[model samples]
Target: MEYEPAEYQKLQVRQYAPRELRETAEGKYWRQFKAPIVAKQFGGVTHIDFCQQYPYNLAVTASTRVIIYNGLAPAVVGRTISRFKDIAYSGCFRSDGRLVCAGGQDGVVQVFDANSRSVLRQFKLHKRATRVARFGADKLHVLSGSDDVTVRWWDVSAGSQVLRLDGHRDYVRAAAASPASSDTWLTGSYDHTVKLWDVRAGGSAMLSLEHGAPVEDVAFFPSGSIAVTAGGNCLCVWDLLGGGGGRLLKRLDNFQKTVTCVRLSPLAGPDSAAAPRMLAGSLDGHVKIFELDSFLVTHASKYPAPVMSLGLSPDCRLLAVGMADGNLSVRKHARPKRAGVGAGPGAPEPRQRRAPRLTAANYRYFIRGQNSRAAASDYRVVRQRQVRLQAYDRMLRQFRYRESLDAALATRQPEVVASVLEELAARGGLAGALGGRDAEGLLPLLRHLVKYIAEPRYTRLLAGMAHRLLDTYSGVVGTAPAVDKALGVLRDRLAEELGVQDQLSGLAGALEPLLAASLAGALF
Candidate 1:
């Protein structure tokens, strides 16, 4: 047997904000497609990153464990590497995505095989907590920053220290590898400065640029000629091309809270002349995407709690936000309007395979170059149109008599007509609904009410309407067969009810004299 949904489940679902209201730029940017897919965590998420290639797996660092998730289906954890002796703060995937690396509070950086969950290399050089670590462009070295105020590089093959660049006055928080060249990178520190590093040359830093506040996160543009840093509610972009150290390209300060993380879109590349967008995650649970050329926030969204980290899949279809409440929120784009093996826009329509009796509507549609399947879908019949009664019920409760009566009459349904009449009587709106209606327009509702004139629940409300309708259309009733029959039935039911009332009145009249006689005898 095949499974089927219940009847109530087959009703059409509506969007929270329909398409007509989202024509403006701001409206489209803020519209939420759907509810987020949530994954619970034992501790707050600290860092997240997606693989550089297809399948685009996710690496998340939380508490003392680093977990890997299949980006395509995030409901399950692929692997959990909990061998860390202390809290793990940051994690990233290598360019090939075959290995995952993380920095921990135990003053060590460890790299593990993506599938085996076994540590491939562990660098124990930092004296204090390691803040960030990621693979370099060469994929043979691991770069890390630590609370010891130093950024260090370790050779993955040798599993030993390559160089230690120490210049920051405070802990280093964020770092990024340059994609255009393997020898260069950038680091941001709480010391309120961002330093450019070149491992090929032995020095503290190739160049240092001053920022007025502590740096929380940093990212390099696709061309490696620009860099962005997030800190203290502001984002600063620098141009690294001029003869001087570097020039300030732009400063974005619209956020109301500190910006904790910044990431460049994976779609950005060096060859593209158009300015690419970057994402900024803040402590206020809001994420903003800014275009580099205009320095304007083009899109924004909110999470359930303060966003601790953010990542986007390689295909740009999936976005993951890690929140302070220990929940991961994943959002997806809407599916295309038409999708099938050969159903894309402008695809040639398939010819008719069989002949059947066709209607004028379908014939005209196909003649206009529309697909037969699409035309048939437009004329499909709906079995449960009663769901629209909810809207009428709302109007009646609000005393919108004109709208309620029109909707009830359109359906010619007994239950709906009776409901509208009862509400009109209760709210004193019968005159407003039917005061000036013509005979033809009011015939359907009158016929439905006369059929149910004997039921107690509907009798009182229907009787008043039947009398008012007859008074308006009495002379013309004989011209229409349906109207004449309904009028005769209504008259007979009303007369029968009046006969019962007369009998009850006479019995009360006789009992009144008997009661008076009994009272006089008692007094004597």
Candidate 2:
């Protein structure tokens, strides 16, 4: 005969647990980057830019120098340009990766040859500090913005300013050259306005729009038909082909601090035909990526300090963030090597496999009871396990309901007691198990009921048990002092819970009118 083990009762899940954040494709892709490599500078990192050509060198502008880092070996410094006597700003590379240009605190824009680190050209026209500088689409011209409230275009072949636009009343801090055309440029100013300029036209702006806050940075979509502006805490998108002045397509206010930089994802990847994404960094130490079409935030990353500038490589293999604390963090993704494939030039070699030991020829390997070992084709017997039960379970199996309840209570586990009580109720023996209990035996049950009756998870079951308890002990209430005191405490707790429910109902009623009014106004 075989003995069967009694099944353990499962406890009900009553508490609410918050759901975890769902991981998206964008999150998985971005999370492939390994831990960042941090570098410290003399002062805050004002700007970071990656070259468009092969090797994809990174240019970082800080205090009084521009440091060029090898893209493949990010921890290695390839070149340093320290020609600026004062602070340098917005150091960026040309499309060919041969020339670098940046603005200076001395109101000068200088271009340096990447190989020799020599200054090739300098445009010195602005009266105040020149803060923004970048190479134009043609790679032969440079565009610069200054604190003197002007935007100047310079020719690299000849050291001369080609075009100057002077419509901004405040300092121009942000500028971008269109990817589709060499004649068009976008500039953002502290006057809360973004102006689009075409060099073929006059010096005045061709189109202007109010940003409602001081503009920090601006970018143009690859098609040149859409523009994005970053201001106070908002990123705005505009349609350039919409009516006369263009229309505001969307206003995304997702950050609590100023948005300092905005950039578009690379358009040269295999997924280039897919909808593009916009990346924005804020002083809140977060960089959020949003879908251009839906404007929904798909992923986000947190930095140690406020992010002042950030750049993504052309191949999207590296992410560089410059912080206000002078920390430059660079993250790179390492692709997994396929089995049986050769490693790349700098990849580490695969580990060697060790040969197995000659165990069959060793006498000790077989002498220690090894002859009793079973062969692969041999059959074996498995012994059945003996069942073990707890004291409460054993009592319940014997149909001693009262003793089982006592054992469950002595365990001091609320779930165990609740399970026993539920089992007794299901078997239609609850009244008999609870009967014939003196004041000392009934005190624990009363205390447990009083403590848990207010909880929504146990209210329905516990409240019915409390009613039955009162009906059974109505005649003996005054005789037992401890039992009488517990009943009084339970009465007070129920009254307090009722009062809380009434107050919550009143609050809900008060908020109804305001919500209705807001909904009505939105519809109208």
Candidate 3:
């Protein structure tokens, strides 16, 4: 509305360091980021990005990670694609689906073989981070785009660079080669242009993507007649049939932020008259789908974190969506057998949506925003917290009390559970998760209140719940000596109904409740 200039201009997202980047940059850039903001302007469904729940892939930004869900049941399956030491600018799958190649801010391209969980190789490409990589027309060759504004070729099998494709005025953000032509390639740059490359002719201007903002990603449709691009928030499909001219097939104008990833079906429509299905993800945490022929958005998935990467398996039924958080989700698209209007009671069962198969090996895990040195730091913190939680939970099951307390106090059994929670507190995880809700987390939580929390200030607030439960049962009859003595005197007469017995006082003093459950009604 009004221009107010301070002493200096604000730094851009690129200028901010990984740790120093602005908080909520996605909402700031996507003016209509908030729901109310969108509803105020246009009364329509705002968020539409399809988020996968299975772990088929991971998308990384700065130090945060987004998992790509492989459309499996309870999606967000598979291993995380984590292994990078710094912010990953770009990444892609190998031709065989075994290797994931990524370029980081340190000007290094690290190749991680999915099956081995090892870094096969890491080599410096340009002074700046590399952005994108595409398989050469034959799949033997590899091409990478860089911030230094050059495209380099790699002999992937040899693990060495064979040549560099130069000739761009600004940083090249996207690079792709025509699937049919061995010598032909295309690269899009921040300089507001996409150029065609001919390997035989040796690095010269071939064509450009005429768009408003810098091109983030580009891909060729199966027909090769057009190339699709996710630029800023808009989706543009350029006509490649006519010398690759900037013929717009369709555009979605209301996307609130930059587009993250896009995928198009390899097979066009079922028959000649069918339209292709296009899926696009964005930084605002939405994946939108459009029918290529009609240019209409037909489906969407809303996510809590920004989507950073995406992939589709050999069959398009499984769509993997990656979020800025360290969770990948895979969503299965199931079409009803009967397409038109619904009519039958026993329709051939609505097909189930499922995530693709994901294992520790082929999991698309995005290791983002972590420097190599910092990766070591994150692993230590994340893993230590995990183990601490398990230990704390195990200690609180509270199988039985009276038969165990005297022995536990004597053998340090309660002390051990207390010690474990202390260890977790040292790591800073259990204490936070247990917060106040730990009252019922472990039965021992009541047995050992000081272990989870030193102060029971809020716990006495459960007096009402205690009254309700007690209304249905008798008092535990222990807190005071008089009540204990009276209960003991009356125990013999009520033994048959309450199932009480004068058990041995010897062996019961040494075993845990679980170990104690094995030996019932034995005082000896």
Model 3, 313-379: lDDT tens digits are 4323445555656445554444311321222222234456896655556534344334546644464
By summed lDDT, the worst window of 10 consecutive residues in model 2 runs over 336-345
Q: How accurate is candidate 3 locally (lDDT)?
A: 0.53
What is the lDDT ranking, best to worst?
2, 1, 3
lDDT of 2 by residue, 1-524 (tens): 99898675433423433346677666776777789999998889989998877567899999999999999888999999999979999999998889999999999999999989999998899899999998987888999999999999888899999888989999999998887888898999999999999988857898999999999999988899899999999999999779889789999999989999998876432134347678899999999988876899878899989989989876666789999999999998764323123222333456678865548687665665655877799897767866677777888787888888888878876667777888888888889888889998899888888888897766877888888888888988899889989999999999999999999999999999999999999999
Which residue pairs collide, candidate 2?
A: none
Better of 2 and 3 by TM-score: 2
Off by over 4 Å in 3: 1-83, 243-252, 267-273, 325-327, 334-524
lDDT of 1: 0.78
Q: List TM-score per model, in order.
A: 0.61, 0.66, 0.48
Clashing pairs in 1: none
The TM-score ranking, best first, is: 2, 1, 3
Candidate 3, residue 29: Cα displacement in angstroms equals 32
How does model 3 score by TM-score? 0.48
